[model samples]
Target: MSYSSHADEDDDVEIEEEYLGDYASVRSIVKEALPFQILATIGGAVAGFIFAGMTNELEMIPGLIVIAPAVLGMRGNISCTLGSRLGSAIHMGLITKIENNPELTNNIYGSLLLGLIMSIALGIIGHTMTVLLGFESAGILALTSIAVLAGVSSGIILSVIAVLLALGMFRFGFDPDNVVTPSIATIGDIVSMLMLFLSAKVVLML
Candidate 1:
């Protein structure tokens, strides 16, 4: 009986080792994907079109008007990029979350905190630059506040979606390299534009 038990333990160890080896192979496969990088470029072009249309419709001063769309686009792009990176990292066991792994959780929190700070700074700079350039349609403080809020919210939301989608793909044995980045970026752009438009409309009403 003891001999049989020992054999069972050995089998379990071998199985675990095989699983680990397979995981490494999967990670390497994902890393080799270069074509996936084009998603960022594609996402950017799409964002440009959306922003142009939204801003043009507003009829605000071109200089002041451009700030909202430009910053929103940039924020959305950065958020999507971060989401892709983090999603990949999380899947490869490079990071873990509190609910999943304590270290990963801390890293996610830190990323979000930084996102908030960056959003505020970017918004303020965009509004200030326009104002300094003598474009007054987008009231500096109000527009800045809106930009900051939108950036932070968009960043956090996209990150969460990316992580969830990546995990789901992994569970289903799907290739995240082919699935995640563009989808998250495209979705993020849509949401970012909507947020910017809503905020601008609200500010104008105030």
Candidate 2:
């Protein structure tokens, strides 16, 4: 009985050590990721402020307010997905270095194509909703043009940023999964808002 008890005690100690080691590893990753997360969150807030400042312009178009959030949210969603996929590829050793590769090219094209299709759909939906709610709205063609142009412009920029950030974090020995999505989301918000505002201005002018 005494010998059995001693062996059980040794096993418990080993298990405890293993648990502690795993905890420490997770803590280290969180520590490494926290700063980048904080910065990205701050960037997101700034983007919100910019969006708020565009209220007057949005009011002029009546239904544009409906379109704005969809555009911004879509950009963030697409970019976030892109970041996650690239991070996974990095972890899997599929992206050994940051250069032109089939995986990267496919992801870029796919994301951009999706963005283009969704932008047109969102524009139509936004315009329909505005009319149904008895609000004046720009023509569907104009709205669709605005959404597609802004979306494509922002999408292109965000794709590059996501790829670079993921690769850069991996190169620095940090986990790309921990940093890429949040960072791209923040950047996506800012760029999408800016591009939307500019696109609206340009489209309305024409």
Candidate 3:
């Protein structure tokens, strides 16, 4: 009876330690997150540059501006979620190495498909809003086509990059969660914006 009571007490103490971490644990967490924060800042700057660079494309494509923010935000949101899932998979040891992995492929495919569908929907919504707001906008067909093309191309490229980054971090014996945020924000933003404008250029041919 006394032994069982001591075991229970020990379990309670461990739970407390887990929740109320000591100073070293807190310091370690901050140290780990600091680098990611810096990288995220750099990503924000790059995203800003992309935003500025798209001014001409936006002007050239009548309805491009309407869907621009949605496209940019959608990429980050989806890719970030994908990266987080991958990070969890890595921690769970469900994924080993970066190649010849069926699990990785499925996750990538799902994220891509989701992004593609959202892109088409966003294009339609943007086109509708633009027309209703009394703004001169491109035809629905043109806008929707641009969104589908851009979203697919960017999704494929970013999925590859995301998997590589997630696996790379784990292979190097580091936590992917530590930096996936910045990776998704930075690289995803750049690629998505570039594809958006490039698709617009092709569709508008202006």
Indicate whether candidate 2 or candidate 3 has the larger lDDT: 2
Candidate 1 local lDDT, residue 128: 73
**Candidate 2 residue runs with Cα over 4 Å from true position:** 1-24
Which 10-residue span in candidate 3 carries the lowest summed lDDT?
A: 19-28
Backbone clash numbers for all candidates listed: 3, 0, 0
* Candidate 3 per-residue C-alpha lDDT over 1-206 given as tens digits, one digit per residue, 9 for 90 to 100: 69999999999999888755632376656766688778777877777787788777777678888888788888889998899989998889888876788888889989999998998898899899999999988878888888888888988988888888888877766668877767777788778888987898798673
* Winner by lDDT: 2
Task: State the C-alpha lDDT per candidate.
Answer: 0.65, 0.88, 0.83
TM-score, per-candidate, Cα-based: 0.64, 0.86, 0.85
lDDT of 2 by residue, 120-196 (tens): 99989988998999989886887888899999999999999998999998898777888898888888889999999
- Write model 1 residue lDDT over 100-137, tens digit each, in one string: 66555654576577767776676677767776877664
Give Cα distance to truth, residue 199, candidate 3, Å.
1.4
Determine the C-alpha RMSD for candidate 2 after optimal superposition of all C-alphas.
Answer: 4.5
Where does candidate 1 have its weakest 10-residue lDDT segment?
55-64
> Candidate 1 or 2, higher TM-score?
2
